[model samples]
Target: MGKPVLIIISGHPATGKTTFGKMISEELKIPLVSPDGIKEILWDNIGWKHDFTEWSNVGKVSFELMYYFIETCLAQGKSLVAEAHFHPEINNARLNALKDKYGCKLLQVHCKADKSVIEERFRQRMASDNFHPGHRHGIVEVYGEEKFYDKLGKGEKLLNIDGEVYEVDTTNAENIDSNKVLEFIKSNL
Candidate 1:
């Protein structure tokens, strides 16, 4: 069997990563892994808010763990698609290491559907995210969309730091050739 494709769909939780990831996984006939799903599967152990450390540290640890999970599946020659925020700043380094370690291919698919679509998605996600009353304090499953966009703008600053990294804006990225997205990946590869 051929080596499996390690596709990491990175975007905010509500931003169609799950939807697009599922679509790609189906099209490619690969196993789909969502960090959110993984989190939910181990929610009690991992907890909701990983506010213990800086963004990069927590993400680095999570990325390392996810890397192992994805790599194991890949080594078994199983195709896999990973869906999550996969924060670039923290996860990219480990991804690079994984690429070198296992000859694994890394495709960072940026899920950028429209804002309204994203808002709707998040609403549905928060509702089904196992929200409990009086369990966790200040646990509101709401996305600060504007804040997220603002943060994304800031994060883009780091993009140029790594020329090999692929970038795609899937905003209005459905029902057509997400060729720009593909081109972004092909160029990087």
Candidate 2:
């Protein structure tokens, strides 16, 4: 009924991005585009091998699907929330182009946590057999604890999207303040 808004939930691993994204998706009634979710589907289809290099192909295909969904949602004038780490090395031009074409507002929610807390959660996730395969591998084990911490510490900065941005620190708590995230989305909507 109105212009679609692209709510991007982004941050370092284990920072509660997915949790916040799910809440926003429910509250706003928009679809969630999560690469991690795609990776899990890939795992279900191809099976998880517990191999170190499994994330590479999975990530590629997952993002391909993600972009397709993004384009479709924007084209059809449907608001959506996309979840991802949004690392600095990642490009934003594609999303920007879509925004310019669709006249959609890009609302950013940046999740964060303390370094030690992130390390503990990441290690715990890596050790969990039931965790998403893409979430479990490489982030902590392959990069090692030091590099992983460093990466999370120097996490990505926000892009210059033409909308408001919200930050949540979920270091000590299991629950994020979803109400605040929802309020932000509603305000923008």
Cα distance off (Å), candidate 1, residue 121: 4.6
Residue by residue across 79-188, what tens digits does model 2's lDDT show?
99999866545647766777899898888998888878887887777788878654545454544556666766464556556668898888868566678777877887
Q: Best lDDT goes to which candidate?
A: 2
C-alpha-based local distance difference test score of model 1: 0.56
Could you tell me every candidate's TM-score relative to the true structure? 0.62, 0.85
The C-alpha RMSD of each candidate to the native structure, in angstroms, is 5.6, 2.6
Which residue window of length 10 is worst by lDDT in model 1? 153-162
